[model samples]
Target chain A: MNTLDARGYSCPEPVIMTKKALEKGLPLTVMVDGVTPLNNITRFAQNKGYKVESRAVGEDYELTISK
Target chain B: MKNKQTLLIAATGLVVGALAVLLTLNGNPANMGFCIACFLRDTAGALGLHKAAVVQYARPEIIGLVLGAFIMSVAGKEFAAKGGSSPMTRFVLGFFVMVGALMFLGCPLRMVLRIAGGDLNAVVGLIGFVCGILGGIFFLKNGFTLKRTYTLSRLEGTWMPILSLGVLALLLLAPSLLAFSESGPGSMHAPVMMAQAAGLIVGALAYKTRLCMVGGIRDAVLFGDFYLLYGFVAIIIAALIGNLAIGSFNLGFDGQPVAFNDGLWNFLGMALTGLGSALLGGCPLRQLILAGSGNSDSAVTVMGMIVGSAFCHNFGLASSADGPTSAGKIAVIIGFAVVIVIGLANMRKEKV
Candidate 1:
């Protein structure tokens, strides 16, 4: 289970980073701070054949992307 | 991925545009909403680069944009501090982009906003922009290139943002360091916090999507891709709705605020802008965003635009409601010739 910290970041960068991580064939947890970034990361994962489930805990978001 | 990107871009455009309309309603200026070149000119004037009294303000929006993008880029771990991509060439390109935009009284973003607000003059400008883009495409196909940029220290990317924050500090604590117009276009602005917020949000969004009108059109033209264009189309539609809600929609061409009816200059001016922006690789707003993202080449371009703005106003080369001065006409003509020469001279040899 790999963990990626993408908190405090903005949009496309988080999404791009996530894509790179996925390409290396790793499935795990990604953290995004903002609603925009969280949503974008989720979609970027899903569109690339990954399953995404997200949870918000007190203003921070954790996304689990899996095959 | 493509569809989601389009949706995000559209959503960003809608919200940002609504803010622009709201700002205009709050006394920023009609059809004069969210113009990068105008704001740059105003900032240049504020810094005493030129003496255009009516158009001098260190727009908080521009500062916010740079800083916000800086913050996001740093946090995203996507910040690359590099440049040196033909700085002088880019500077001249920025100068001409601003000149062309000023002649038409707006950048491509503002052009769409204007037309959405019902300014018909922008249609002609649009035509010119497309033609210029077509010319630029001709050069690109013929191997026009600006060569590769060498990477520099990450500290290089930090300079633009650091400078932005310092300016923000100055604007907040020691306003006397910079000159602000007591009246005229410079005096007109949305509230500081509001403009800054708008700029910050936009900077963040732009950094993410890499939203660029010139890039979008260039892609659409050269590669037959509409992914970028979709975002722009959504922006216009969103702006149109915003204008409609506020009764800012004035369909006819004449009597548009801060703009006049000389259609030829409108066309020619935007043509210059289109070509210049294409040659330079992005529009003025994109340049600002890229500067925030740590591109030093873009920083030089921004500086070029600032100086060009000063030159235009100081030399009586900017157009007014009475229409373009003869000097402005001559400058536009010269701008076209110079841009064409740049396009032609910069072409690379075809590969074997």
Candidate 2:
């Protein structure tokens, strides 16, 4: 399992980073501070044959993606 | 389920409009909230690139927008620097786009903003913008392309962002280092903190959605894709709602602030904007975002805008409410010719 912390960053980037992590064929936990990125990363993963589960951790979100 | 994406995008549009209205209510000019071209021109004037007294301010919103976008790009691990995609051509297109935008006194964002605030003058500019986009679509159909940009070192992408941060710092710590207008639009601004927050939100959301108003219209025209247009439409709806709530909605052509009454040039001005921006492959806002994200080609285009603004101001090529200066009208004609030539020259023909 890998942790991808993308807190305080905006979209496209977090999603872009999440895409890279998913491409590594590993289960990953992604932290995103922005609502836009949280939804975007989850959508990108779900669309790419991965299951995504996200939970709020304080003001940020933690998203889990696994094949 | 089907409208999920549309709803999501429209939400971002709503945020954009909300902030824009908030800024206007907080002392930003009426019908002049968040114009990339105007802000860029004002920035250039602030730097003494052109001695335009009435429009000189190192707008923190512009700095914050680029800086915010750049920060996001880096945080997302997507800040790759690249360029050489007909950079000079892009610069020229950016230049003319600025020329056209200033002549009419706004960008596509401002055009929509104006309409949202009930200025009918923008209605004409909107028509011109559509037509200009149609012209670009014609060239696109004809195989006109500015080519592609290749990846460069990551450090290369840091320059513009660094520059923006530097500007932000200077504006904050050393106020006298940069010029600020004592009157006119340059002098008008929302509180610095509010402006920066608005710009940051907009920059970040735009990055996430890949929102491009011109792209939305172009996609709708080219491929019947209304996905993006939904977001564009949402901005207007949200803006109108915001303006009404703030008691800023005017509802007419007469007495619109920072807007010209001339219909034809308004049409032609935005026609030039639409065509040039279409040819350059993005609106002024998109260009700023792209530059922030480390695309040097876009950086070049941004520079072109700055230079274009200076040239327009120095050469008497910008229009005002009284109407376009004769020089501005002449520039628009020349601008059309330059853009058409660029279009024809770049277009490649497929062999049957």
Candidate 3:
């Protein structure tokens, strides 16, 4: 499992990072600090046909995306 | 619960729209209240950053907006000092956004208001704006990004708010220090305190609701999310009702107050604005709110806008009611070129 810390990034940035990380193969864990990024990454990952599981990790969100 | 939240967002839009109309009725230019680009240009003129005599004023609404967002963010525990995410790039994007906005004589927010006031020229602008956003969405799907931001000291985040307060102080205590328009759009204004109050109220609501016209349309195209778009639609409806009630609705393209009937320039101008704002991750109003909440990158963006406003007037690149100047048209073309280059340059190389 590869974890990408996207905790402080804003929109489109997080989604882009997720796209880049997904290129290296999954299951991938993405961490974000806000709802906007969480929702954005979830949307991006789901749109790409990946299964995404998201949960709160102490005021931040962790999303696990897998094929 | 989601329905309630959506309704509250709509209510916020209504209040904002009604305030805009009230501001217009109370002395602000007809159909010309709360234009972020115009206000920044006026503020630039007031500061002597540009010699545009007819548009000089230290607009209190701008100050109120920043301070309102600052107070709300602090109270909500949402304020965080952050920056260092390609500040110069954001600055350039901000500058071009202002360029496009001045060319069109409004921002996306004002574009909506113009449509509500029955300016068909704005309808043409809207079509251009949506086209630009769709273009941005293409880049977004291809992994366009401006990189990530870093956390900074609290003092770094407070600079914009402090600057806002300093401007407010100057506007109140030392009015003689800044230039005031003798006549024209700058000379016409709502009472300072009333306009400030209106800005404060709208700023607070907008910050809370994350009301951003660029984000509204971008999200709609990117994620099928209409959450943000609903706010803008509500604004149009509310402002439409207010305009009709006040007999301010002219319902035509020609002779609309403070707007030109030139459809092509209006479209291209807003197209540039939409593309720039989409690349910057927010619109001018959103940049202001983000700056208030301690985003130094956004503060730099706002500064870029001020400078851009000055540049537009100083170099004769801004349009007037007579319509877009030749220089302004060329600048808009250059703006599109620069923004497109930026969009292409920022795409992840691997993805491209």
Model 2 lDDT, residue B191, Cα: 91
In candidate 2, what are the lDDT values of residues B245-275, reduced to their tens digit? Answer: 9899998887898987999999999999999
**What is model 2's DockQ versus the real complex?**
0.04
TM-score of 2: 0.83
lDDT of 3 by residue, B133-200 (tens): 88887887776878888889999999999998888888999989999999999999999999999888
In candidate 1 chain B, where is summed lDDT lowest over 10 consecutive residues? B222-231
Interface RMSD of each: 11.0, 11.5, 3.6
Which lDDT tens digits does candidate 2 get at residues A4-28?
A: 8766433334554565566565789
Best by lDDT: 3
Model 3 clashing residue pairs (backbone): none
lDDT of 2 at B256: 92
Across residues B256-340, which tens digit of lDDT does each residue of candidate 1 receive? 8777789999999999999999888778888898888788888899988988899999998898777888888888999998999
Off by over 4 Å in 3: A1-4, A15-29, A35-67
Please provide, for model 1 over A21-62, each residue's C-alpha lDDT reduced to its tens digit, 9 standing for 90 to 100: 666566778887555567667655665677988898665689
B-chain TM-score for every candidate: 0.97, 0.97, 0.98
TM-score of 3: 0.92
Q: Estimate every model's Cα lDDT from 0 to 1.
A: 0.80, 0.82, 0.87
Q: TM-score of model 1's chain A, to 2 decimals?
A: 0.87
